[model samples]
Target: TGLTPWLAWVRGQAPPRRDFNPCGAYRFVRHPVYLSFMGLVWFTPTMTLDQAVLTGVWTVYLFVGSWLKDRRLEHFIGEPYREYERRVPGYPLMLVGPLATKRT
Candidate 1:
């Protein structure tokens, strides 16, 4: 969600702190916006051939991009991001019940 990254940005702007924010929308998933995009693309009532191809390509991109982003976050935020990864489910799993838990 917008608020998640915005909070991170705000934190980064402050002095003597480089913290990981696993709050709000991020409590459920690492990439809530991408999950939302997947839902919008896949849950359409009808899909043309072009739409289907686009959906397939975009889905692949989302997963691959998320993986790369995970690497980047781990490198940038280090242990905290890794610990957050251990706690939160990614993507589709986040949509399911009981998988999401709030962690400080």
Candidate 2:
């Protein structure tokens, strides 16, 4: 089990952790926990067609957020987290950035 708020604290977003798994079941998703929680909470039962479109756009934004996080983790944690990323497919895992070309 994971704690969204506590993890956020670990990531230095909040002041500190006060409880365990503060966001309940949303701990499963591994990146940008706040964004994920907001999406899960507000994505459905939209009031209008425009709202539905906005929800779709928001989901895309969350996915990109997760991808950027993975890139940062790879840079920071190095090979260990990169291997984790390779093993566990990144959320929405779309390739949006420049390719790593071979170098001399």
Candidate 3:
């Protein structure tokens, strides 16, 4: 976790990591960061026109960004992340994305 896939890609290999495992919030959703941030973005008490516009934009951005991140993480993190994707959704609350596998 020293450098992200973006920064470490220049080195022509996966990041130098001993291991990768999903735990805690990751066990629930593949994109916990985006999920939590999306929640914060939509919780505005006063939904002014400009605020609503900004919130809408951020919502779209987060969805797209989370999808892209999934692809990127699969590429860099390899099979484990792919397995996780198969078992989870990008947004579990909305039941979004593919597979949505039932874990044993």
Sorted on TM-score, best first, the list reads 3, 1, 2
> Cα miss at 2, model 2 (Å)?
18
Q: Can you give the lDDT of residue 2 in candidate 1?
A: 46
Stretches of candidate 1 off by over 4 Å are: 1-16, 94-104
Better of 1 and 3 by lDDT: 1
The predicted structure with the larger TM-score, 1 or 2, is: 1
User: Lowest summed lDDT over 10 consecutive residues: which window, candidate 2?
Assistant: 95-104
Query: Please, what are the lDDT tens digits per residue for candidate 2 over residues 1-104?
Result: 26886787789896452332213333323454645665674756646878767767877676667667767866756766554544333333423332121122
Looking at model 2, residue 57 earns an lDDT score of: 81
Writing each residue's lDDT as its tens digit, candidate 3 over 63-94 gives 78876877788787898887777677667655
User: How close is every model to the real structure, measured as TM-score?
Assistant: 0.72, 0.49, 0.74
Query: Once model 2 is optimally superposed onto the true structure by TM-score, how far is the C-alpha of residue 67 displaced, in angstroms?
Result: 1.1
Better of 2 and 3 by lDDT: 3
Q: Score residue 37 of candidate 1 by CA lDDT.
A: 94
RMSD of 2: 9.3
